[model samples]
Target chain A: MKQDPDKSRMNFPNRALKWLVILMVVFLVIEIPLLISHARHAYFKIDGWFAFYAILGFLACPALTFLARGLGVLVRRDESTFGNEDDKTLPEDLDEQLR
Target chain B: MNNFADFPPALILLLGALLVPFLKPSWRSVYVILLPLATLFYVLQLKTGTGSQFNLFTFTEEPLEFLRVDKLSKAFGIIFSLNAVAAFIYAFYYKKSTQHVAALFYIGGAIGTVFAGDLLTMYVFWESMAVSSTFVILARNTEQAKGAAFRYIMIHLVGGLLLLAGVILTIARQDGSIAFNGFDFETANHAGTWLILIGILVNCGAPPLSSWLPDSYPAASVTGGLILSAYTTKTAVYTLLRGYPGWEPLIWIGCAMAVYGVIYALMESDIRRILAYAIINQVGFMVCAAGVGTHDAISGATAAAFCHILYKSLLWMTTGVVLYRLGKSNLCDLGGLHRTMPVTTVFFIIGCLSMALPGTCGFTSKNIIIHAIEHEHLFWPWLLLEISAVGIFLAVAIRLPYFLFFGKDKGLTPQDAPSAMLGGMALLGFFCLFFGFAPGTLYDLLPHEIDYHPYSIAKVTIVLQWILATGITFIFLKKWLTPKPGISLDFDWFYRKGAVQFYRAADTTLNGANALAKRTFIDGFVKWTCNFFESGASRSTAWLMTPIWMLQGHNAEEIDSLQQSIFKRSKRGAFQIGITAFCAVILLGLLSIIFLLE
Candidate 1:
C-alpha cells in the first residue's frame, strides 16, 4: 500500500497555530518599542504608560468569561423555555420545514 | 406645483411592491431587484431641498412636506437604498412572494421616515415600518415567529403612540409648525420634546427595553433576520442624530447599553442571538457619538452607522447561510464546518470587519468615534468603551467562529452555501475592503466636511497589540470558554413572564368571581322563584277545583287538562319575568351610581 498522503500533509490548524504564535511574537516585539516612543493624547498620563491597552485586552477576556459564567447561572434556562406551547416540543413537521 | 421633483423616492418602492403579487413567477424576481434600483436612481436625481408636498388634513394649516432632501437625509437615503439592493440580492432564491412584498414596504417606510420633512410624516412612516416588519417576521410561519412577532409589534405600537402624542403636543405648544429639527434640551421647557426623545430611545434599543432585539430577531426567517438587522435601530439612530444631538444623558445611557450587550452576548449559545446583542452594542457607540453632538462626533456617528449597516448585515447573512444549510445555529451543534464549507468560512471572516481590525471598514469608522470621545476628554465613557471593545473581540469576533469552525470536530459535513448567496456576500465583502483601503469615498458622503485620519503608526500598533493579547488570553482559556447550551434571561422576562403571570392571575380571579355570581345569585334565584310559583299555583288550583266540582257542570278530564296547561304557561312566564327583573334591577343600580358620581 502507498504511504498515506493525508499523513504526509501538515495539519492545517497546527501549521496555522505555529504561524499565529510567530505573528504574535513579532507584534509584541514591535509594540514594546512603539510604546516607549509614542506620545498619546490621553486625559491622564497613566493612560499612556507602557502597554496599557495590551494589559487591558489581556485581562478583560478571562474576567468577562468568568463574569459570564456567573451570569449564566442566574439566567440560564433550558432552550425550550422560550416561545409558546408549540415550540416547547418540536412539531412533527419541523424536520420537513427545515429541509 | 406637482413637477417631477414632487415625486418621493419611497413611492417608487411602495408602488412596485403593490405590483409584485400580480406578476408572473419568473417576473417577480426581476421586479424585486429593479424596484430598489429605480428608487436609488430617483433618490440621486433629486435636488437638495424640500419638494414633495401633500395636504395631510385640516388639523394643521400648512401642507406637509413629504420629501426633505438635505445632506443628512440624502446620506441615509443612499445607504438605505444600497442596503435594499444587497438584501434583495441575498434573498434572491426565497420563494415566498409575501416576504418580498413585506421587505419592500419595510424598505420604503425607512426611506420615507428619513426623508420626512415634518413630524406627522415621520409618524406615518414609522407606523408603516412597524406593520411591514411584523409581516416579515410572521412570514416564517413558525409558532415561535408568531409569538415573537406579536411581542415585537406590541412594543413598537407603544413606541408609535408615544411618538404621535409627542408630535401632537409639540405642535400644540410650538405654533403648530410640526417642523422636524434639533431640539435644545438645555432650554427644553415642554414635556413634548421629552416624550419624543423617549419614543426615539425605545427604538434605539436603549435600556430597560433593549431585550426586544435579542428576543425577537433570532425567531425570524434566515433572510428575514438579514433584512431586520439593517433598518429598525439605524432609523432610530438617524432620528436621534436629527433631533436629539448634544443631549448629555444619552452618552451615559449609550455606554450602559454597549457594556450590557456584550455581557449578555458572552453567555448566549445561539449564534444569531449573539449577533443580535452585538447590534445593540454597536448602536450604543453611535448613540454616544450623537450625544457628544460635536461636528466630528456627529460625522463619526453617521459614518459608523453606515458602516455598521453593511458589516452587521454581512454577519447576519453569514450566520443565515449556516442556518439554512445545517438547520441549526446553536454553537453546541456546530463544529469543523470550515473543512467542508471553506467559502462560507472565508465570507464569515470577512464579516468580522466590525471588530475594528486594521484594514477593515470598521477601523475607518469606529476609530473616529473613539477619537471624538478622547478629544472630548469624557474619561469614564472612554474607559468603558475601551473595555467593551475587548469584550466584543472576546465574545463575538473570536468566540463565534472558533466554536463553529474549530475545536472538538463534531464530525458534521454540510455543503457550501449556494453561488447566489456567495455572490451577495462577495458584493458586501468588496465594500468592506473598498472602504477600508480608501476612506475618502466614504468620507465624501458624510453630511459634514472633516479632516480625520484613521490610520497612523501608533493607532495601528495599539490595535494590533490589543487584538493579539486578546488572542493569547483566549488560547489559554479556550476550554473554559466553550459555549454551554442554554438560554440567558433578559429584560423581556418581566413582560414575557411577570406580566404574563399577572394577566393569568387576574384572568383566573375575575373569571372565578363571574362564575360564582352566576351560580349563587342568578341560577339559585331563578330556581327558588320557580319552585315558589309552582307550589302556590298547585294550592290555588286544588282550592278552586274543590269549588268547581260542587258546581258539576263541566267534564272533569277537560277541566284537568286546561288546569295543567295553565300551570305550565305560568311557570314559563315566571322565569322570563325573573330574568327580566334581575337585568332591570342591575341596570337601575348602575344608572343610580353614575348619577351619584356625576
Candidate 2:
C-alpha cells in the first residue's frame, strides 16, 4: 500500500521532530565525553561535575518555563490591560475637550 | 583650523543633525550614513591622552577637560560610530527626516559622553543623550509611543538628576576637582558615590527601576528602538566604569538584573519586547564586570560593551525588517517564516551571536567576563550568571527563532528584507562574524593589556554545553516554553498604575488641605471679622448706654427700650449723635493711650 501525499505532508512535523531529537542525541553523545575531560582544568569545581551544563540546561528550561508560567498567571494580562490606563491622559469626550 | 585635530568627533554628528532636513531625501540619507563614517575616522584619529580644554568663564578653578581619549573612550567611540553608520543604513529607505535628525543627535550625545574628560562635561552630554533619545521614541507618534517616551524621559531625568547631585557633592568635598575617576576608599563610602552609583544603575536598567527600558523601548519606531538600544545603557556602563569601579553592590544588582531580564523575556510574547528585555540581560554582565573592577575585568567589560552594541544592533535590525515587512511582530502571530524570509532568518541566526553560542561574538566577549569571575572565585555570583546564561540562551536562541521563524506555519508569506535593509544588516552581520572569528582584533582594542585568550578548548566547550542543553530542553518541553499572547507586569506597574496612585495620593493630600483651609480661614474667621466691622457700632453703643441708664435711675424696661431704639437706628446707618459721639471718643481715647504707652 502506498501512503497518501497530503497525509505524509501532515506527518512532516513528526518526522522532523524525530530527526531533530536524533541529531541532538548525537551531539550529546559527543559533548558528554568532551565536557568531562575539559572539566579537569576548569576553574569552577562545578564544571568537574558530570555533564554540568547539559544537566543545568536540561533542568533549567522546564523550571524557568513553568516558573514563567506561574509568573504569567500572576502578572499576565490582556493586551488591553494597559490600554485604558494609557488612555487616561485622553479625555473621555475628546472632541469636547479639544474644543 | 591649525588645531582641527582637537575637535571632538561628536560635533560632526551634532552639526550634521541640524543640516539633515535641509537636504533632499536622497542626500539626507547619504548624509546621515556619511556623518557616522566621518565620526569613525575622527574617533580613530584621537590619540590616548587628554586633548583640548573648554573653560566656562572661570566656572572651575582650572579649565575643564572636554576631550579625553583614553583607551576606554576610544574603544566606545569606535564601536558607537560604527553602529551609528549601520543603524542609519538600516533606516535609509524611510522618508521621515525627523527620525534621522533625532538619531544623529542621539548618537552624537552618546559619543560625546564617551569622550568627556570631566564629570560636568560627561553629565552635560549624558543628559543630552536622554533628551534626544526621547525624540527618537516620539518619532513613532503613536499614543503608546508618546506614553513610553514620557515615562522614559521622566526616569532618565531622575537618573540625570542623581548623577548631577553626585557630581556636585563629590566636587564640593574634593575642593572643586571635577575629574571623572573611580570612587574608592573613603570616597566609596561617601553618600556622593552612592548617589552616582545609583544614578548609573538606573540607566543600566537595574531591577525595580528597570522596567522603564522594557516599558518604553518596545513602543518606539523600529529603527528608533535600534538606536535607543545601542547608546544609552552602554554609555551608562562607561560612566559606571569611570566613576564607581569595584563598587560591590553592583555585583548583586547586576546578577539580579541578569536573571530578572531572562525571566521577563521568557514571559514576553512581543518580539521587540523580548529583545528589549534581553538588553537588560546583556548589560547585566557588563555591570557585573564593572563591579569586579579588576584591570582584566574592565577590559572584559569594554570588550563586552563593544560586541554587545554590534551584535545587539544586528538582532534589532533583523527583527525590525520582519516587522517592516509583515506588520506583525508578536510571537503567536508569526511562525514558519524561514521558508519565505530566508535571508532575514539567516541574518537573525547570525544576530543570535548575542546568545554567546560557540563561534559567535557573544562567546568571545562573554568568555572574558566569566573567566574573570572564576579567576576571582566569586561562586554565588558566578553560579547566578551561568543560570542566567542558560535562561537567556533558551529565551532568545531557542524560543524566539523557533516561534517567530520556524514553528507551525501561520500561512503568511512575506518577501525577504529589502536590499537596503539587507545591506544594513549585512554591515552589522559582518562585524559579528569579524569579531567572532578574529577576536584578537577586538582584544587589541581593550583598555588593559590582559594576558587572556578567549578560544581555549575548555572555554569553547562550556558555552557549547549551554547551547546543547538549551536546545534539547527546548525541543522536548516546547509546549511549556511557547510564548502566549499576553504581556506580563514588571516594576513599571508601580509607575504605571502606581504613578496614577501616586497622583491620587498627592491630589487627596494637597487638595484636602486646601479645602480645609478655605473652610476655616475664609468662611469662619474671615466672615466673623467682616460681620464685626459692619455691626460692631450698634452693639458697642447699646452696651455703653447700659451703665449710663443705671446711673440715671431709669427703670430696666425703659432703659432696654432706649438701647433697642439706638441699635435699630445704627443698623439703618443712622446712629444717634450722642451714642456715636461716645463710641468715637472711646476709640480715640484707646488709641491715644496706646500711643502714650509706646
Candidate 3:
C-alpha cells in the first residue's frame, strides 16, 4: 500500500512530538551533571540545587495556566462585555428604522 | 555645541511631518523614509556631554535642556529612529497622510522625551506622545478604536498630570531646579518623587494601569499598532532607568505585571491582545532589572529595552498582516496560515528573539538581567523571573506560532503580507539574528562597560532543557490549551465597565433630578407668578375701575379709553426715559461685578 503524501505530512506533528521527548531526555542526561557540577552561589540554598531551574520551568507553565483558568472563571465575560447594544455593528432595529 | 549638533532631532521629525501632507504621494514616501534617517544622522553627530539649552523668559536660574547627548539617550535615540524607518516601511501601503503625520509626531515625541534633560522638557514631550499616539489609535476610525482611543488618552492624560505635578513639586523643593536624575528611597519618600514614580509606573504598564496597554494597543490600525509597540512603554522604561533605578518595590510590581500579563495572555483568544499582554510581560523584565538597580541590571534593562522594541514590533507587524488580510485577529479564527503566509511565519517566529532563545537578541539581552539578579542574590525574584521566562516561551514563542500557523486548519487561505511589510519584517528579522550572534554591537552602545557571556555551555543547556520541557508540557496540554472565543477581563474592567456604568447611573439620576426640579420649583414658580399677575391684576383693576366709575359717574369704557390715551402720550416722555436709565445702571453694575470676580 502506498502512503499518501498529505497523510505522511499530517503525521509530522506526532513524530515531532516523539522526537521532542527524546531530545528532552538527551538534554536532561547532559544537563543534570552540568547543573550538579556547576559552581553556584545563591541567597537561598534550594535555588542552587541541581535541576531547581528545570523543575521550576516544568511546573510553572501548568501552575500558571491552571491558575489563570481559575481566574478566568472570575474575570471572564462575554465577547462583547466591554461593548453594549450601541456598539453593535449591525443594527438590531434595522427593519423598524427602515419602515 | 555647534549649531548643527544643537539642532534637536525631534524637531527635525516634527518639522518634516508638516511637509508630509502637502507632498505628492511618491515624495511623501521618500520624505517619511528620509526624515527619520536624517534625524538619526543628526543624533549620531551630537557630541557626548554636549546639549542644547534654552532659558525661558530669563527668570529661571537653570536653562531647560532640549537636547542632551549621552550614552543612554543616544542608545534609545538610535533605536527609536531605526524603529521609525522600519515602521514607515511597513506602513508604505497605507495611503492616509494623516496617519503618517500622526505617526511622525509620535516618533518625534518619543525622541524628544528621550533627549529631554529636565523634567519640564520631558513633560512637554510626554504630553505630545500621549496626544499623538491617541490619534494613531483614532486613525483606525472604527467604533471600537474610538472607544479604546478615548480610554487610552484618558489614562495617559492622568499620567501626564501626575508627572506635571511631580515636576512642579520637585522643582519647588530643589530651589527651582528641574533636573531629571535618579533618586534613592530616602529622596523618593518625598511626595514629588513618589508621584513621579507612579506617573512613570503608569506608562511602564505597571499593575493596575497595565491593562490600559493590552486594552488600547490591539485596537490600533495595523500599522499604528506596530508603531505603538515600539515607543511608549520602552520610553517609560528608559525614564525609569534614568530616574528611579534601585527602587526595590518595582521588583515585586514588575514581577506581578509579568505574571499578570502571561495569565491574561493565556486566557486571551485574540492574537493581537495576546501580543499586547506579552509586551507587558517583556517590559516587566526591564522594569524588574531597573528595580534591581545594579550597574549590570541597568545595562541589562537598557539592552533588553532596545532589543524588545525590535522583536515586539516584529510580532505586532506579523499579527497586523494577519488582521489586515483576514480581517480577524482571534486565534480561533486563525490556524495553518503558515502554508499561505510562510514569510510572515518565518518572521513571526523570530519573536523568539524576545523569548531569550539561544542565538537571538533576547538571549543576549535578557540574560544580563538574569545574571544581575543572580549576582545580586535576589533569590525569590530570580525564581519568579525565570519562571516567567518559561511562561514567555509558552505564551508567545510556542503557543502563539503553533495556533497562528501550525494548528488545526481554519480553511482560510489569505495570501502573504505585501512586499513593503515583508521588507520591513525581513529587515527587523535580519537584525534580530545579527544582534543575537554579535551582541557586542549592542553592548558597545550601553551606558556602562560590562563583561557578560550568553553562549556558555551550562546556560545554553539549561535554556534548551527548559524550552524543551515547556514544549512537551504544551503538547500534552494542547487540547486543553486551545483558545476559545471570549474576553478575559483585566483591570480595564474597572474603567471600561464600572466607570461607564457609574457615568450612566449618574447621568440618569442627575437628569431625572433636573426634570423633577424643573417641574417642582421652576414650573411652579412660573405658573404661580403668571396666575398672580393675570388674576390679581384683573381683580385689582376691576375693583379700582368700579369705584372710580361709581365715584366719577362715568362708564368703564370711557375710563379705559382715557387711560390708553395717557399711556400713549407718556411713551417717549421723561418718566419712561428715567425708568430705562435706572435699569441700565443696575445691569451695568452687575456686569462689572461679574467681570471683576472673573
Q: Which ten residues in a row have the lowest lDDT in candidate 3 chain B?
A: B566-575
Report residue A50 deviation for candidate 1 (angstroms). 1.1
Per-residue lDDT of model 1, residues B1-598, tens digit only:
3334567789999988999998886788777888998888778777786678778587786678789888778888888898888878777777558888999999999999999988999989989999999998888778888888998999988988888889889988778888888888776547898888888888889988787788778888888889899899999999999998899988998898888888888889899999999988888898998888887888888888888888888888888888888778899999888998899888888878456888888888887888888889898888888788888878888888899877668888878877767877887888888888898988887778878987877777778777878887888778777888878988888998888798999989998999899898788988888777766776576568755765776577767775775577666654357866998999999999999999
Docking class of 1: acceptable
What's the lDDT of the predicted structure labeled candidate 3?
Answer: 0.84
Tell the DockQ for candidate 3.
0.26
lDDT of 2 by residue, B1-598 (tens): 1233487889999998999889999888888999999999988977898577777746676556668889999999999999998988888777678888988998999999988888888888989998999999888777888889999999999988998998888887778888887778454578777787778889999988899998888778778888999999999999878876787888888898898899899999999999999999989998998899888889898998999898888989988877777667799999999999999999999988455876777888887888888888899888888888889888987789999999899998888887878999999899888888888898889899888876766667767776877787787779887878878888988888788888999999999999999999999999999889877877887898789999999999999899888777867877568967998999999999999999
**Runs with alpha carbons beyond 4 Å of true place in candidate 2:** A1-28, A32-39, A85-99, B1-5, B185-188, B509-513, B516-598
Query: Which candidate number maximizes TM-score?
Result: 1
- Cα shift from native, residue A78, model 3 (Å): 1.5
lDDT of 1 by residue, A1-99 (tens): 885778657576787788678756766685765766664445656567666777878778888788888888899898666544344543221223445
Which candidate wins on DockQ?
1
Q: Which is the winner by TM-score between candidate 1 and candidate 2?
A: 1
lDDT of 2 at B12: 96
Error of 1 at B266 (Å): 0.7
Q: How well is candidate 2 docked (DockQ)?
A: 0.31
